[model samples]
Target chain A: MSNLVFLPILIPLLAGAVTLALWRSSRWQKRVSVISTLVYLIASVMLAQTVSEQGHIVLQVGGWQAPFGISLVADFLATIMIVVTAVVAFCAVLYSLVSTPGTHIKFGYFPLLHLLLAGVSGAFLTGDLFNLFVWFEVMLLASFGLLTLGGERAQMEGAIKYVTINLFSSALFLSAIGLLYGSVGTLNMADLAVKLQDVEQQGLVNAIALMFMVSFSIKAGAFPFFFWLPASYHTPIIAVSAVFAGLLTKVGVYALYRMFSLVFTGDIEFTHEILLWVGVLTMLSGVLGAASQFEIRRILSFHIISQIGYMILALAIFTPAAIAGGVFYLFHHIIVKTNLFLIAGLTQMLQGTYELKQMGSLYRQRPWLAALFLIPAMSLAGLPPLSGFFAKFLVIEAGITSQQWIATGVALFVGLLTLYSMIKIWAEAFWKAQPEASGKDISLPLLGVIPVALMAAMTLIIGLYAEPFIQLSQATGEQLLTPATYIQAVLGGQP
Target chain B: MSALMAVAIGILFAASLYMMLRRSIVKLVMGLILLSNAANLVIFTSAGLTSGAPPLLDKVTKEAPVGVADPLAQALILTAIVIAFGVLAFSVVLIHRAHEVVQTDDLDQMKDTDQ
Candidate 1:
């Protein structure tokens, strides 16, 4: 393997160190951070291209082989995730560059954000399950710093709940790893895939699988584990919230797809049913929560959980088309969710608050911002010709194809309620008029508008040119369903 | 020894659950600690009991492949212990900040402002 294999992980980490070590000069910190992220974006794109052409790229660190030392594998799925992560992180940084100025909070948020992205990218690319846990800790720990950056009382309260729940989840995840290792004697995901195939103890495998699901589901904020989300997410600054809303829960979903398809495929009957029901319940609860919320970010947070249900539902179907739809939904949701959160932040910026009741008739003042937000909002509700629509269409079509009538029915109902929730936001924030003296008038810079506009355009573009995405998603899903490609890459072909 | 092991598991389970069920923030923190430690013990016991041997080699004979404890479980348990401690410390500071800033310990007090 080439040395460049490590650059994707190294570049941002080095940048983080430089930023933190040289914190005295804000100018140098900004320059260092921005340059590194741009480099990371380039490296990740190149890595994706390399993987697309050459298949899976594996790097064993410290010259140690797999199953003993950590390995980073850039398979098609991981590469695609990395590329999407780069796009989101790039846009987030661009938005924050404009939004961060003149704020009382220190600029240390940038470095932490970079480290968080590095960790997320690492998690997606790493082939080792233990490495995934470590990367998750890296991201969440950095997030802990970023979430409490402003030192606001509400943010502190929310951060405590956020960190506590995540900590508990991490503990459960570690325990699961211990049990899985004791059972299978290997922690490498690919090696586990092979070893678990021969394991006869169905009950023990199911127990460990459930433990893993509980851990990831908490991160994903599925039903019965979503209490931490609405409590914490709304308290962060708009820029922070937008980026997190777009990325964090998706990490959980990614883990679910990774482990279910890879490590625990033999016992599908037990896991699939639980996931399907969880998906349905999560969707219903999220939409209901969104419908009842008056605060802008809170409603968006609820919708985040609701949208995750769609992805899980697609996975539950376990068909090629359904899994493909799930992949499509994951891609579409990331872009749409991030852009929506950005719009919420932009709204908060313009009106100086996030309460829909306090700030009304926004379209009259900022029609363009309203348009930017409106597109993604409508798309999120699965409006026709938008990315969200295509995503939902594929999932629903898969449901119909698989004869999952109940799931299909639930998805349709959720879509309708989502539409209702979107309209509620539109009506409360844009349709109703507020007096001039009620809210402060604030103007965001043009640079801030560029990232949101770019993402919004990408969302529309995905909806329009969905064939390539769907094809890519299909190929990725095929590779996932058939584990030979992965197994061969991890375990040498001596046997 | 078997009875002691059973009692240990039982006590760990009860204390951890009690801590976890408490509504107070401090108790919640303690609950997580107890729960994680209990989990570590479960991992320890499930791997089998090795009372005779330490992992280190004998110093006097300098023997090769001497009787050593089960290394893998100990390594796994050690990692778990470290992670739990880190999380506990982070939670402690986080809770303190929440208390200082919000001037409240009751999580219910931190409900939605609009409500």
Candidate 2:
């Protein structure tokens, strides 16, 4: 049973290898990629079920003892993340079948996508800090390949900024790990959680914690370190960007939540207070940036940053309900954001541009696409009876309950701003009359709409029936807030 | 010895950040390489440098080691180095490609993507 923890990572890795072997046959590659992702999704669901039933699954590689060998622990939070990752990966691959150009498919796009899935799963499941770094690299390298695969002029430009900033962040992450190992003498997160509490030099531990904070802040696209995201995200193909928008920054948020909740609880007032301001600033800056953008993808890109602010805010609040809100927000945001990007791709497929000025009358031409878009667009704005509404309700409710008036106020204000921008996209792209200079119309590909429709339905389902999802998130929150079970699971009841 | 190595690492980091802030993408890649190397050195030094002794077990006793260098840090550095090398190599090629297409090494000229 413990061995099942490896399946999520192993399946995608094997799939990547198999897809690479079948590279010459694009048709076979697509079939294999889709089938593999389906299998991976099922495995993830099984893992999530097992975790919810049997508690955390801890696997020490090669049968080594916990502290010495690398460990992979799948608690509720991790399994949930893995499950969502597989869902997004499956949708992205399915969408990519008709959407990704032949040139891209021929150039190992499917394999790279699978590799990314492997990296994301590994990042979610790994129980060691250094091991997390390794997974991050795997993810980064694969993303770099995916980002610049076409070597288009814009892609090259965007990839340059993305690559440089991410590499710098990785350097920061590596040095922090070094300092952490130097201080704690263990890279395993559970052991670090145990030993970090015992270290005499609390100041050094705090400093290292700050270092990790800065590193992950950069990765998470928090304010002052998020310029790279908007600059690069719009340059990739929609499928690639959808997967990225769905999974990548969320991974950073997950790390912050995991580390702060489990390991860095010594100086909550200092560290989390800083996170509070960062989250607020991230929200304001990102929404304001989106408000100023006329391009659809750029606006969406900036909104990603703003949405991240909400998740970080939830983490900063540091209560059970707050963390649950963050988890719920993460779950809701990934689905809605990915669906929006895919819908943007569909609009592009119809209108041949991501520029709002050039796109118009989408509703008149394709009412179904507009309707599909509304599900996610409204949910993203926290409209009632939608998934985002509950997500935001929990987050803001937690904030108010925790006496974080200012942060809560900003979250509410950001929700309004989010709606404003979503409406902006709606007005320009769907509601307005078609411009004279817009390109020729291409019919919506059925293949493209399937994933978007399915994901939108998922958002609707999670919205209308929010009980089970909210309960799961709350349970994850409780588990994260109390790391004793996680530690014991990994360390085999050893103190 | 630790103080000297720390100073060296600090210098590497400073130089890298300086180079990274420049407009030339080539310098940016160079700076990244320097930065990753500095990070590797930090990990190597932080593990408490031990000279000459390798971490190994006795053939019979299987637990004879004492005062040996930390093998974990070395393994970590090796992994970091390889990953960094892969990323840097890709960036170098990306820079070369960007140069060919954009026709400028200056990152300022690459702002068309921002629009």
Candidate 3:
């Protein structure tokens, strides 16, 4: 049971290898990838269940001691993330089977998907900062492969920008880890949690913390560092974009949440203050960017930046309730954002264009598509009786309690702007009576609709039955706030 | 000696940043290489300057050698260098492919998606 953490990382890695071996046989690749993700889903659920009931589970690779060897630790926060990764990865693979062109599958799309899952899992579970960097590289390489799979001109352009920026971030991440290891003399996170408290060189520590902040902010698609995101995110195949938007930036947020909570809490006043302003700019600019875009995917790409702002705002506040709100938002945004991209893809399939001016009759021709799209889109806009409303409400409540009035105001304004852009999408794409041209084709199989509908159903389920999810996030947030428990578990309760 | 390596790392970082700011995609790849090597050098120097002594422990007494280098830093750098090499290789190929498709190396002209 305690070995479940390793299973999530291992299954995808093994499946990726299998898929690569069977790449010539697309049938085998699909079978292998789907079964592997299903197995991962089951394992992650078991891991989450065990962590919820039992405490954090820690495994030192090769039976080495915690500080000396690589450690894989599954705390509540990590387990929930792994579970979410499993669910999203499952939907993404199913959608890829129908949406990804045959040329892409030949280029090893399934294998790359599994490799990305392995990377996300590794990032969530590693107890050492260096190990985290390795997992990031794993994810970067795999995403690069997927980004350029089809070899299209637009995809290559997007891939070039994406690759350049991400590689630069990787360099930054490495340098930060090196400096941190030099200053603290250890890379194990739990050990750093204790070691950093004893260091009196406050300025140096804070400088290194800022380095981490910038690196992660870029990854999270936050403001002042989000130019690459909107430039490139829309160029990929829908399955690729859906998974990337859902899980990639969230990994960045999770890293921020982890480091700030565990190791970099020495000078929260300075570090988190910077984070707060970043949140404000990111939210305002991201939504404003969305409003100005005419392409459907372009709008959603910008919203990814905007939504990242909300999570950072919660993190900047750094209260337990605020962190809980951030966690809830993270889960909600992954499902809703991914579903939006999937719907946009299906819309392109049926409506014959990605431009808002040319798109129409989606609701009239396929009311069911409109309904499915509405659930997540409105949820994204924080409409009542949907998941997004509760997510934004919790964060705003936390802000109000903490007297963060300006940020609270900004958060509310962003929600309204979010609704405006979503309505823009609704009116332009769905509610419009018809386009000027009558020759537009709307032929799409129901196979591609399954993943979108499934994600929408999840949004509805979580929105209506919000209690259990809220409790889980609260528990996850509680675990994040109290780093001592994590340290104790990883270090065998050693002082 | 370690201070000298630190100076070199700083120089490398500055050079790479300048290169990365250029318009040419190939130069951008060069910058990425230099930047990654700079990071690896930082890791190497951070473990301190060692006089190339063996890090092995004696079987007879199980005592570690004096002035021996910390092998851990070397190990970390080795891993980083490998990862960087993989990324750099992929990046070069990506640049080449992108150049083939778009027919230009200037990143400014690659503005098809923003509109």
Candidate 4:
């Protein structure tokens, strides 16, 4: 059963390699990509079930011991993340079949996309710090390819900033790993958790934690470190941007969750306090930034940053309930945000532009699309009986219970501002009269609409039936709050 | 030796940051290369400056070796170097392509995406 832990990573890798070999046949590439992601989704569900039944699945690669070799450990948090990733990847690939240009597909877009998934899964599963770094690089390289695949002028401009900032972050991550390894002789996360407790240089450990915080902050698009995200995310194809928006920053948040909960707990006052403020500011700045943007994708890009703040706030609060809320928020946000992007792509297909000013009469032309848009859009704004409402409710409730009044207030304010932006889009893109000069409407493809509708249905399901999901998130939070189980599982009876 | 290496790494980092702050995209790439190299050096220096026998076990005794330099640091640095090299290659090609399409090397001029 432990072997199943590797399936999510392996399936995507093999799919990527096979798709690369089928480069000349875009038809086959599309089939291989979609089938593999479906398989991955199945594997992820199986892994999640296995994890639920048997606390954690730990696989030490090549039969090496934990401290000396890389380990893949899938706790509840990891399993949930893997499942969500597979869901998003499957939807993105399905949407891509009709959305991505044939030229991009011929140029290895599917392969890169699969590789990116592989990297994301690897990062989630790896129990070694350096292995995580390696996975980050893998994801980065594949994303760079995906970003610049079309080589459009705007893409080139965005890619430059994206590439530079990510490269810098990777360097900082590596340096932190080196310094950490210097202080403590192991890179395996479980071993580090054990060793970090005994290291006499507490201040040095705090400093190193800050290094990691900054690096991940950049990756997660926290308040001051988020410029690169908005600059690049909107430049990619909608399918590409959708997956990136859903998975990429969340990976950083995942890392922060893993590290802060497991290893960096020594100086919680010093580190998490900083994170608390960072999260608050990130929420404020992100919402304000979105309120000012008229471009649909750009607005959503800023919203990603803002929502990231909520997750980070949950992590910063660092209670079991808060973590649970963060987990629920993470899952809900991914589906809703990705669905929103897919809907934006549909509008672009119909209106021939992502600019809100150029899009209009969508409500009348395609009422179904408008309704689909409203499902995710209203869910995003935390409307009742929706996934976003429950997600936000849990987080805010956790915040109040934790006595984080300012954060709770800001969160409520951000929700209002979020609604304002959604309404702005509603007014400009869906409700307003059609501009006379806008291009002729292109019919929305069924394939593209399927992913959007499916995801919207998922949002409704999660919202309407919140008990099981909340329980699962609570379980994930318990697992995260208690790292001893993780260490014991990975180390295998060795104290 | 450790102090000297620390100074050298600091200088490398400073130089890279300076290069990266320039307006030219080409120079930014150069800074990235330097930054990665400096990071690799940080790992190398931090792992201690021991000059000892190879970290291998004796064939007969299996564990008789002593005073062996740490092999793990070198392995880590090697991996980092390889990954960095691949990234640098990609960035180089990306910059070349950007120069062709966007028709400017000035980083500040590539603000069209923001608008």
Candidate 5:
């Protein structure tokens, strides 16, 4: 009831305003942004600890009661998501502090990044469905600005597709909300979870659930809706791409996870089967696309879609262990993906380009960078004892547990192909001789390596000490399967 | 009234999809607007088209609040309208910028982003 729940959103929102006010000086902007992100990280970690120790926290804005008032709820899933978001965001700010292009530094990058974080936090914490829409808008607008910050031709071109597809997704999402409201007459998610059970029109409920599935699938960069991802994600600055790669699609996954688990369990067999097929196709298409790409960022972009498939696959299985795998995969993927993108940027910085064909000699010249890159890359490829291995292990175990042979098969196959893709990068960019004309001998500052090293260490730490993360995800999966803890925490005991 | 509105909404949705399917980016933007408007109207019609009395507290408190229109749908529509407007404004500017930079409003010509 007190204000702790709102702190995650407020810290970044206020920091955004402060950064905008100090826009004339990049020095102050950097200091304020980093400090605010640190504060956000602390607040979010404290929130996670609080949620684990004392159960979910719910705060209603304007002191109005739930089912009427807009509320923020930080259950285990939401709090853990907030914590990962803070970590990724802090890394992004740190990365930007070192490598932001001159043109972008004075041009509202810090402010927009702060605003985007605020929106992401808000989306993760909100209890109302409509409030989620509002947060999506917040994220969309800030991302729009960040995407096109430099106003270069390629940036503009990619921004159009990114903004257009996201806007379309929002429209679809709004339409779904409208229809859901017309059917259920409640915008609060917990309230809908309760009311939907009493609604006799199960077929209509299933239809709307499908609408939600498709909408969130697009945001999550799943199959048939992933074109905008590979198109635009490669165009942004590395810092921007790192944040977008890490957070944006996951927000969509979070939404899908919340709705399907909580509000739309009436027709699971039908809707989840749809998700199941989509997940397999998404995985196949993404890895295949990655296999053919020579551009480094584009390949990673496709892999993002591929990894999304694993997450969706976990959700499709829908068992406690399967969902736990999905949650674990999400946690591991965010860290690994964001770090990979950062290392890609660093590679681009060192070689003066992102084309893998034109890049080489990192192994000979800068073994440490290669070493940093190998940890996350191997983890992403599901190497044993790495974070990706355990993430994949849980999901595949869950897939087998559920007897979904084809999906389970595809999940395993994708892990192999992911290693193949990572090895392709290793061979081209690190193992081969430096190309005659392509080597530029560019240098990146030590600060740029700070975030990358930190992420690499975290990946190692998680991989070696996988028990804690697995247990956390298992608890999260339990809360999701029940949904009463969440519903009760948000709606309280007034009934 | 609800039937007519539903018909109009269907028409709008179909037309917008037709526009969106075209290759021109400008049409795509227009299609997005039409699609969103159609969605708003869908919400409007599905909530019922009764011309009802104001939902004052006294009226709402009564057990039989006669002819009181559903205010929630209207509120949702308004919020959607505002959000859609902001999105559309951004889209329009992006289209113009893309046109200026890419020198074409045709989606096919804008393949510089994809590797």
Candidate 6:
């Protein structure tokens, strides 16, 4: 059981190292990377199952007890995140294998992908704040590598801006950690929760919390700090872009959920208010940007910013149902967003361009492909009977219950704009006429289609049978709202 | 010793911030190195400045007094240094690529790539 807890993090890192050493041999690197990620995916699934059965799995590294050495806790929320990350990462690996095998970035791509997954998974599972910062850097460095792999004119230009901004963010994160350690005297998150409960006048705590929020908000691409995301995200290859678009911002969102729910619960009034306003502003800006977009992938990237607002709004509400809805929303958005990007990538392949202005009559040439694109697009637009609807429904329901008029209205308006933008893509790319088809026809291989199909099916599955996930999310929400569970786990049942 | 180390920390931070504001990428890299070193020094200073008081205990006592250096903080700083090294390596490669692909060392030339 303890071994299962660490396997998800360890396998990917070890495999990543091996991939690097074997980089000159593509066959060995590919084999090692795929096998390692598959092992990680299986471990995450098993860990999720164990959490469902046993409630939570906690392991203290190197036999050091919790609250002393770093500990990894596989709570329902973390396990679910790991499972989702593994699924999306696996799809990315598969997609890259078939689509860009001979591209210049192919040699070192798999290793970095594995390391990124390892970092993300480790960040989710760790119960220590400083460890979280380390994992954040680990993931950020790998992502920088992945982003700049091709060394193209556009990629290098974008990577510089991306790295500079993120390095600044990492500095801020370290400073925040320094402040947190100075004030709290312990870097363990669960211990900090306990300590914070006793600290009078939470001014310092609030200050640190705000610092953490700024660092994460920049990564999550919230309203004021989102300029870096849209500028750099669209410059990379689609496989890298798809995984990043799906996984990276969610890491920031994940940290926000962890910290606010656990260590900084005192100033609900100020924190929740700020989150609500930021969310609404983020929604408005993202939708407006999407409305004015020419490229298909860029439109989707902007939509990601808009959709994040809904999830943050859920946290702002600060209710069990609301947190559950946010969790469910994150789960749905990851799969759907990744699927949409891959489909867009395929469209780029067929038409030799990513601009919607140049892409049309896709449906006429490839009817099934158009239909495949519609499922996630409609899902993104909050069409019923898809997972997106349920996620949006719960968010709206939570807003209504909280009676936050602005958030609820913005959510609805954003949903409509989302539908409008998705429809614009559908009409322009699929229904309208194409000036040139590039070729008479081109058939996509199974590897290309399978990943999209798998992600779309997972989205549909979650929507149709949301009972188990809803139950798990409810449990996670309860644990988050009542963080005594985490504190107890880390402090060894200490009150 | 602690006071002297604290002054050194301040100097490192000031120098790093000055370099961070410079327009050149090489200076930016130098700035990051200095800033990371200063941060590690902060952790060291906070742990205490006694060079003689090793954190490891002799046979006399399993738990050291408050005067002893904190091994925990030292371990953390070491890990942070390694992480900083990784970041530095990545930055070196990325800057090289930027110069190669964009044909410019100045970030001002890179602004046109923005949406």
TM-score of 3: 0.98
Error of 2 at A283 (Å): 0.9
Q: In angstroms, give how far residue A11 of model 3 lies from its true place.
A: 0.9
Worst 10 residues of 1 chain A by lDDT: A98-107
What is the fnat score of candidate 3? 0.73
Candidate 2, position A396, lDDT: 99
**Per-residue lDDT for A1-495 in model 2, tens only?**
888999999999999999999979999999999899999999999998899898799999999988999999999999999988989998999899999999999999999998998999999999999999999999999999999988889899999999988999999999999999988899999999999888988889889999899889998999889999999999989999999999999999999998999999988999999999999999999999999999999999999999999999999999999999999999899999999999999888888889999889988888988999999999999998999999999999999999999999999999999999999999999999988645565777788989999899999999999999999999999999989989999999699
Instruction: Please give me the total number of clashing residue pairs in predicted model 1.
Output: 0
Candidate number with greatest DockQ: 4
- Residue range A123-172, candidate 3, lDDT tens digits: 99999999999999999899999888888888988888888888888888
DockQ-best of 1 and 6: 6
State each candidate's clash count.
Answer: 0, 0, 0, 0, 0, 0
TM-score of each: 0.94, 0.98, 0.98, 0.99, 0.97, 0.95
* Cα lDDT for residue A424, candidate 4: 99
What would the DockQ be for model 4? Answer: 0.92
Give the residue spans of candidate 5 off by over 4 A.
Answer: A437-441, B59-64
For model 4, how does the per-residue alpha-carbon lDDT over A1-495 read when each residue is reduced to its tens digit? 689999999999999999999989999999999899999999999999999999999999999999999999999999989999999999999999999999999899999999999999999999999999999999999999999999899999999999999999999999999999999989999999999999999999999999999999999999789999999999989999999999999999999999999989999889999999999999999999999999999999999999999999999999999999999999999999999999999998888889898778999999988999999999999998999999999999999999999999999999999999999999999999978645465677899999999999999999999999999999889889999999999998888
Tens-digit lDDT string for candidate 6 (A1-495): 766888888988998889889878877777776777788788889888888887768898888886888989888789889999989988888888777646643558888888898899999999998899899998999899888877778888778778877877777777677767766678888888888888886888788889888888888888888877877888888988999999999999999899888888888998878888988999899999999998898899999999988888888899999999999999899999999999999998788898898889999888988988988999999998888999999889989998999889989999999999999999999899986666656778788899999998888888789888788778888878988777777677666
The lDDT of model 5 is 0.90
Clashing residue pairs in candidate 5 are: none
| Interface RMSD for each of the candidates | 2.4, 0.7, 0.9, 0.5, 1.3, 1.7
For residues A1-495, what per-residue lDDT tens digits would candidate 1 score against the true structure? 444567677887898888888777776776776688788889988987888887788887887888787788887778887778878888887787777653422557877887888788878878888779888988888788888887787788788778878987887787788778778878899999989989999899999999999999999999989988988888777778887898889999999999998888988889998999999889999999989988889999999999999999988888888888898889888888988888888887777778888877788888888898888988999998888898899899999998889989999999999999888888888878875545455677887899899999998899888889889888888888887788777665723
| TM-score per candidate for chain A alone | 0.97, 0.99, 0.98, 0.99, 0.98, 0.98
Cα DockQ of the candidate 2 complex: 0.87
Query: Candidate 2: where are CA atoms >4 Å away?
Result: A437-441, B58-61
Q: What is the TM-score of chain B in candidate 6?
A: 0.88
